[model samples]
Target: MDAAPLAARVTRIATLVAGLPALPPDDGSRYSPRRLTVSWLLEAESVHTEIAHARDLGAFLDWCNRERLDPLTARPTDLAQFKVWRGAGTGGTPAAASTVARALASISSWYTHLVANTDGGVTRNPVAAVKRPPVNRHTSTTAGLTLDEVDALLAAADAQAGARAAAAGRTPTGQARYLAALRDRALLRLLADLGLRISEALDRDLGDLSNNAGHRTLRFVGKGGVHRERPLTPHSLQALDEYLAARAAAAGTTADRLSGPIFATTGAGGDGRLAEPNIFMTLRRLARIAGIASADRLSPHSLRHAFATGAREAGIALEDVQDAMGHADPRTTRRYDRDRHNLDRDPAFVLGARRASRRSGNQR
Candidate 1:
């Protein structure tokens, strides 16, 4: 629990992780040491939401290597067959269409990486042509918690806090209460209010929050390496300020330097102490406690969806929602427009049709 030795270990881990290069300068035809280092980092971070799914990603990569299905040379048929192979019962049940689609997306991104790093003449992305099962474009309502559900989740967290304090043989009436209720309430509110991807929130640095001339904005690095700024609401800002204060006190530090992680592990680093717990882990725990879904529905991405749905209901302009969601294509933004679903249920459609038929019968 000593600060000096704890800081030293943190420094050592950072040194090792920081030594990794972002990407290879040249193509993989000529493997450089720097390329190897970058490769190692990519593989290490490949431990995604599911290790089993990540293994499938590796298998797909291996398939590409064996088939020599380079984007530069492979035909559409070849790509289609590869997709079929992925879903076929080669050993077990066929892979889900959604899973196959996800793998294809990852492969498409990998191809984009290749094109960016080397030649830019990979004319076609075959994955674009592959016909898969129709995907329901509707965002799932099952995952996101309504306002009432959020209240229930918050209550559950408070109850857990009480149990913890009781077990510690102390009155549940001091820092313990603040740590449990305030810290986690702020975290959940940030997710719901901002619609921040868990990773985006986790990746937040102190400098990401800025106030200038009485306006507050939270800067975030979004997907596809895009940087975005979202105006912070008064409630969000207040919660953020309180969380920051509590965080500083917990660390036993006073300097509010706009550097270092916005969030970090409590206490000293050890075998159990996380220098930085993965944001996804925080989401999973929260979901488990809140009883959100039987399957995994608690992640940064789910929160992002919840934000989009909330905005749609609030009658925010589609363009504004698109910008908030950090969507590249307007068509992708169009998908989030829940207006169409409501329009589909209009009485005009059924009533107008019946009236027209009745008028036609009279005319006959």
Candidate 2:
């Protein structure tokens, strides 16, 4: 197969995908007017998906070039071959169903858009005929803590702060860690109650906490650099108040140290906002102190999962959960709702299974 023709087509597709006007078709050969239209339509529709769509689309085009098949003449077998190649195991890890699905869907959409605009370049989407690989949403391991565990962790943080207060030393090292523990207690509460991502929580400044009309709120930029202001829960407010007061006192009576980041560096080194790694290491140490099972299994995200899960079980609205978590899509929130993941919740287990009158029941 000639790589030059394929490279030209890929280049045209790339140019359009980058939201640039297409270069004038080269002197050699040109794609149909309908194909160009389809490319732009796919581009317009894929803005929300961004680079992931571009990547999947590029892979499919490369595969089509390797097979020497145009969309106009591409058969169902060609689509199947692409799927097999993409879904093959990497090292020992199997390619995720979600990954395979994305690739197939991108190719399928391209063909679909072309078919919609074309007279006869393509008759049908080959992907439409093939069964989509199943993505089991329940298989995710986004774990949450039970309320008792949550209580224990928070209590452990408070206990550590108290212990550190009593263990005051002349050296700044001990006091720095002590202040850090106080910060960690507050951080844990924010994550467990407010449902903040670690980055969102850490990126907050001192001024982000404000009150309006008797309601306290915390402001931060979420994913996609979208700023969000959520009213503080009572529990979270109380924790924040205690933490902030402790933080202020820990940094001395001066107001300068309190001017910036809500979570400043402590524990003997580093400054100007606590990094995510510091937060993680702090949580790990706190988790061990709290007697939680494994270091690797527990994370700040677990607290977030706990927040969402606990809210769901307490009957908070799903949209409320989405907004509070700063999820871009409600479907993403639904995925985080672990309520349906439990095997015991299935209808296969009836609460009371009657023997159905042993005399009348016939054995299979």
Candidate 3:
């Protein structure tokens, strides 16, 4: 947690808040945008938000340092080089376009913020100066699990949970691991069925899920603190029930059984809310255990993608898919619609039996 070199520059910038010597239009662009990005984001209350912003900022800084480039003097050519470096191989495998797109967006937003807040003193976004890598949102091959794969994952989770429960002993460590297995099963099933973001899945209290007349639903705050409710699928509800039973057994006595996170940490933290990174680790491990082909790409978001895609394939309307996935924009949901984009499974080919029959009759 030691302060970065930019820390000193930011401290100096704070001093110049009131009456600073203004930069001349052409030649006075000497302050590093790298320093400005770190300071600006950290100062704008973004430190408490998504950590990806800081990660992207740090990566950009590292890229600049390695290239012997000054952020203040970076041009369109430098931006293009960064894009190439970001998209191409580390070990003969290219990075995902989505990842490069996010990093570019972070850098672009940093420059835009500087331009706006600094009275256009920093006039240009270097990212805007170059062509960004094309993100093929409509073409996501490894974007999600198939429905059978999702079911297989859930089955694997259940089998593992049963095994752990059977082997669990009186020892604290053994009990915690057993409980963690149970929790992971429920968590994975929830995400797989509900199409929830990791943040939404993790940010839940015990009371968030409620049952009425044998129908169950979850009410929780989503992005932008928007409160939303989604009906629970039967499999998700059953998995949840099993999880709660296991949770009670894991709670022992000292742990509160009724309040706090629905998916609490059963590992070293013991009843503390499980963090997002751990959720990711759990999903990855589960995906590997389930023998998923694209285990590396299987994340909580991937499960969400699976849910949306599977729903679309089942003949659900586009708007319904959007509503179920809690997407404010249909366009966002469209990206998750792998079935819609899958030309090989086109209805024109699959459902053209009458045309085939007519051709056969004419030939006869």
Candidate 4:
């Protein structure tokens, strides 16, 4: 195999892994074993996951270049040093334990692929010898909104929509603002009520909304490419209906004729799907309007956390909450439950009561 420069090889592999077009090999030969392995790994991952992996891998490759270490030939000690550097706040504030852990996992996966496919060229995975930082699975660091804050946020969205709708008759830019407000209202409702990841909500099309067994539901592709449906609450359905109505009015068409993205962009000359940054800005703006303490830090994930936490607080079954949040593991769902530490529901209390009852029966 031809020895390509490490950076060049990484670029080509990342491009291929992202399912993007890549330049032909310089010698017009087959791809190297490492590239082929990356392709295989790409098969099971979503585009978002592949992009994140590429970013993490790029950071590691840059560090290797700076240290004069060959990633393909680096030893266990080299990986250990890299882990320390990754968490050392070299660029700015130190990375979180979860962030460091994810980076190591990315590097480990890369080596695992190479070791499995490179025959004898790459002997073993050095990352395996490095200990990863312990991440707490029982608690989440993501900002969360209280149930009252969520209600206030929804009210703010509703107020914005109403104001914009009234202004639509007076100004040229008012129609666009009105349409965007309507979209934001519906988007927030879905996030708060259904516990959808932002990507899942943005990926929805008009066609994804349907009636299932007398329930109105929105179908979305969740993480790991799992197909799932969430029933729309009455509030969500109403918000969606209002948004579609406004969209149809702006487009000079009927709502039923709309066919593309459910939350299409409202910017001039842009009719594509809504992007994550747009949603992030919307959330922050609405949160500020709602007077939320964590407005500046609010993201779509905050609503997801709120949904899980609120559901658990409402006495919803844990398994049902897990399914709603699309968590593959119950423990992951538990992590989002802010009330997980509530001693009122402790099993120890029940066990102690049982013991007391047994002793009382023996006295009788």
Task: Give the winner by TM-score.
Answer: 4
**Tens digit of per-residue lDDT, candidate 1, span 157-219:** 556545544433243335544544444555666777777766666556667787655788888
Model 2 C-alpha lDDT per residue in residues 137-191, reported as the tens digit of each score: 5445555567778888888888988888766455677777677777788888888
Candidate 1 residue 87 Cα shift, in angstroms, is 2.4
Among these predictions, the greatest lDDT belongs to 4
Off by over 4 Å in 2: 1-139, 254-257, 267-271, 342-364
Write the number of the candidate with greater lDDT, choosing between 1 and 2. 2
What would the per-residue lDDT of candidate 3 be over residues 1-364, giving only the tens digit for each residue? 1255348536544443322122222323444443454456555422223356656656766788778776655787888898898888479899888888888888787777778666555777888978767887655654578888888888888888888876677687778778888888888988988888887877687778776567788987776567888888888878777777767755553223555678888766465677788877777777788898887767678888888889888888989999887778888888887677688767788669779989999999
User: How many angstroms is residue 135 displaced in model 3 relative to the true structure, after the best TM-score fit?
Assistant: 2.1
lDDT of 2 at 362: 66
* RMSD in angstroms between candidate 2 and the native structure over all alpha carbons: 11.4
For candidate 3, report its TM-score.
Answer: 0.73
Stretches of candidate 4 exceeding 4 Å from the true structure: 1-44, 90-92, 117-123, 169-172, 347-364
**Clash number for every model?**
1, 0, 0, 0
Which portions of model 3 miss their true places by more than 4 Å?
Answer: 1-49, 119-123, 141-143, 205-207, 210-215, 221-226, 252-257, 328-331, 341-364
List the candidates ranked by lDDT, beginning with the highest. 4, 3, 2, 1
lDDT of each: 0.57, 0.70, 0.73, 0.82
TM-score per candidate, chains pooled: 0.63, 0.58, 0.73, 0.82
